[model samples]
Target: MATNILVTGASGFVGKNLSTFLQNKECKTNALSLRNENWKADFLKSVDAIIHLAGKAHDISNVSDSDEYYKINRDLTIELFNGFLNSDIKKFFYFSSVKAVADSVEGILTEDEVANPVTHYGKSKIEAERYILSQNLPEGKKVYIIRPCMIHGPGNKGNLNLLYKIVEKGLPWPLASFHNQRSFLGIDNLNYLIYEMLIKNDLQSGVYNFADDKALSTNELISTVNKALGKKAKLWKVSKGLIEKTAGLGDKLKLPLNSERLKKLTESYVVSNQKIKSALGIEKLPLSAEEGLIKTIKSFKKEK
Candidate 1:
């Protein structure tokens, strides 16, 4: 019999991709939106698994109400997990973020790091994780708390999109001198892993950090984007000091390249996917970092 899967936040990027993928594999999917007051009743239906993806994303503008993060990310998750404990569902997948551990990684982030989240969004995620961990799970029930760094795919919109616009407009990238490597997760790999977890019974239930097999520097990323567009990469080796000064001025003038945005662009945040790969008993993910990134960049070009 096909597994009946209940997915929350099915309209979002990750959820939409995952639901489509699962359905392709012949699994029955039911989308649960929090906007429906009787979502709990929908959750209690004959669902064999639950993939919780609903939560307020981190607002870089710092204008979102702090309470909303807790109410949805923390409280709503607690309620859903409690329902899972009492229900017949054998598997539960909760999508978390690496931000739950640290906002800025010193080196490579791993599952072993002690969580010390600084942002309200991070705090809310960790709270939800703690609640799920503290519960006395019944035998045959498995709960997976997955922490994925910057996921990108066909419909993604974020920093990757911003970078694509600059390159697509034939503008030269000025921060090529500020070299940095960051981890990214491809939606295809994530969906494949989740499908494996759904069918496999022996995998342990715990936290897993998910990312691509390799990390790529910003310069390399630009080159990949150019390759996808069939355009030569245009990068200017501007001085790092001048860039920092300009970012400082942007902070004061309310411009786009503020210090925070600059850090996000240039800072290295390498995440280790060894734990997840080891759990899946696989040596490598389905897509290499560059290949997955090229797919994403091509999607952006298509949208143009």
Candidate 2:
């Protein structure tokens, strides 16, 4: 029998990429939007597994309503997870974020962390995680709440696109000297990990951190983008202090390049993949820091 896998947040970045990816694996997949309120419980009844990708993301501008944090991220997850628990599903995969663990960790992020999130978005996700872990799920049930870093892929229009626009315009990549090593979740790697979970039922059920085997500096990322576009890589050595001061003014003026975004652009966030890679029994997926990024940046050239 073909395994039925139901995915939520079908219209979003990861889902759109994963749908096309699974077809290459010959997996039977069905997708539904979270905004689809009329969707019935029967719609999920026969599915072998559920990958819940729907949630409210962190708003960097801090413009979201105070109450809305719980409404979508926390409340909707419990509602969906309860439905899955009661149904015939054996495996449930929920896409959580590393921010739920901490805004910044001392070293690579681990599942054992106490989970101290600084924002309402992270707080809501942590609440959902608490609810899911608290349940005494059935003996055969397996739940995986995966926390992934920034996911990038083709057709993705995000902060990456914004960066691409800056570089493409020959802006001389101003943050060349600002060294940072942030983890990136390639769509291929994330999809492959979830596929392994669907196939390997005997694997332990718990929270997992998903990311590329290697972490890349923001400067390395710019070089990759430049290579993909076949353009000259021109990066300027502007002082980090000056950048931060300018960022502060930008924040006050509501300019495009602000202090918080500057921090995000230059923060070092490295996630360890030891636990997950060992569980899956795979060396690594085919995505490299440069290779995956090249494809993503190449998409912008055609658009321009």
Question: RMSD, each candidate, Å?
Answer: 1.4, 1.9
Cα lDDT tens digits, model 1, 27-139, are 98989998788877776557889999999999978999999999999999999899889888888999999999999998899999999999999999999999999998999
lDDT of residue 145 for candidate 2: 90
Candidate 2 accuracy as lDDT: 0.84
Which candidate has the top score in TM-score?
1
Model 1 lDDT vs. the true structure? Answer: 0.91
What lDDT does candidate 2 reach at residue 105? 65
Candidate 2: stretches off by over 4 Å:
249-256
How do the residues 5-75 of candidate 2 rate in per-residue lDDT, one tens digit apiece? Answer: 88888778888778777767887789866677875544666678888898887897899995798998999
State every prediction's TM-score relative to the real structure.
Answer: 0.96, 0.93
Give the total clashing residue pairs for model 1. Answer: 0
Clashes of each: 0, 0
